[model samples]
Target: MAVHHPATIVPTKLELLQAWVPHQPWLGGADVSTVTRLGSYRFDDPDGEVGMETHLLSTDDGRVLQVPLTYRGAPRVGAEGSLITTMTHTTLGNRWIYDGCHDPVYVTALVRAILTGGRHADLYAATDGGLVLEPATTHVRGSGSWSSADVPALTAPVVSHHGTTTTIHAGVRLTLPRVLVATTPAADASLSGTWPGQETPVVLATVDGSS
Candidate 1:
């Protein structure tokens, strides 16, 4: 489950994304003002140290983008290049945000979820009384593992940007589609999800890993 604190963030998520997304090489020079958030999903950090979230956005010109982000209490040691922006949370104090692709915690959770047939993390709002379930706006699922052993670590992912796909090499290869499509080609493993207006599941990412 993911718990959301009812606190104010100095630079809201959208605000930070606006200032950051345009600089991405794959964005085709689209600015933040033309971006619209379609939906999002979350993954839980078993250790409860990092906040993992993925947002699906669309450009005015009809290009879909998948952005995964991780929020941590302190700076991620060697991820200076992936830092999005820092923000002050009224209740939690400070938060350091980074592109999830470069964060091991996020990469592990994603790989584990795909290998274990895990679903998106359920969300809850922290209220004065207690935690209240927040209806998930998106639904996601992954193909489970074929073995019982723990998922292996992928030291440092080497990323390659293509026109419509972003490939990451870290022992295993992960392909994330930059353009969200209704129908997906066959893949070795995959993560898929559905949103409110879109009843059909959209392929989020595909994995090619050795057994």
Candidate 2:
């Protein structure tokens, strides 16, 4: 529930990790770019328009990045995964925190609210966490998908050792797990948890790498 009103702006999550620590790939080289807070939560979105956040960053080498810092008073357009910036104010007016999950309408409303067990923010307790608390369960979409999980065709069904048993071709027979992706007029379906009496998830082709 931070994000006061836009008196001014700039990256505030430690200046966006000093401009995102040389583009982060787990970051390397010994230097001094510390960001130690370790705990934070909250994301309320009723009428107060809250999104207050904090996670912490810059552990270097070992890499534990969650590095969040939100304070929305505006910007819930299309959220997804999160990470936005525009906040910075000091003359005592405060307000301007952008980056609300890159805004794909708040990442499909936090991926349809984690597939239905929604409750965003699990940075683990530390004063029970902070920021303002939002995803207290709203259906955070969960067929285990941040976009259908790790994308090598949504992970699962593999049996390789020259046996050549890499799965997800899903032409369909029947099982307990289904994630079909071979389209023409919408054939394959069933992502478990009752989401597939058919709702349109029939994308055909492309699993060249494996999720």
Candidate 3:
């Protein structure tokens, strides 16, 4: 589960995206003003060191894009190339943002989610009275192994395919779709889900280990 602290963040998520989105190779020349968030989901870090989030956005032309992000208390070592931006949080202080593809926490959690049929992490909002369940805008379901404990951490560099897929080279190859589609290719393991107004199950990612 994910817990949200009642803290303020400078340059909100959308604000940061506005400045960084246009620099992406796959979204070259795209206008950030027209981008709209469709929904989002979260995954918990077993170690509780980082925040993992995935946002689904739609471009003005109707292209659906998936953006996975990781939040950290400090800058991620050797991840300069993947840095999205740095911002300050009212309670947490400075935070470094990176593309989730380059973060081991995110990679491992994603693998575990797919390999264990994990569902979206439940969210809780910190309030004066107590914690309250926050309704998630997106829902996710996975299919594969049952235990995430056996999954090892990713040690090698993650590979990107045309910005549409992210591949982690661990003991077994894991791939996550960066673009949403009505139909997706099958795999040894996979994740699918729906969002508000979209009832059909859309493939979110796949995993393959046959070599």
lDDT of each: 0.82, 0.33, 0.78
User: Model 1 — which ten-residue stretch has the worst lDDT?
Assistant: 25-34
Candidate 2 residues lying further than 4 Å off, grouped into runs, are: 1-8, 16-44, 54-58, 65-93, 96-116, 119-211
Which candidate achieves the best lDDT against the true structure? 1
lDDT of 2: 0.33
**Selected candidate, larger lDDT, 2 vs 3:** 3
After the best TM-score superposition of candidate 3, give how far the Cα of residue 169 lies from its true spot, in angstroms: 2.5
* Candidate 1: Cα lDDT at 66: 82
| Residue 137 local lDDT, model 3 | 75
How well is each residue in 47-103 modelled by candidate 3, as lDDT tens digits? 888999998887777767778889999888888988998988998899999988778
Q: What digit string (tens of lDDT, one per residue) describes model 1 on residues 37-101?
A: 88889999989999999988877776667889999999988789889999999989999999888
How far residue 122's Cα lies from its native spot in candidate 2, in Å, is: 17
Candidate 2's residue-wise lDDT over 44-132, tens digit each?
Answer: 45444445452434344433333224465455454433434545555333444544333222323332333333344332221324333
Superposed model 3: Cα runs more than 4 Å off: 28-33
- Model 1 residue 55 CA deviation in Å: 0.7
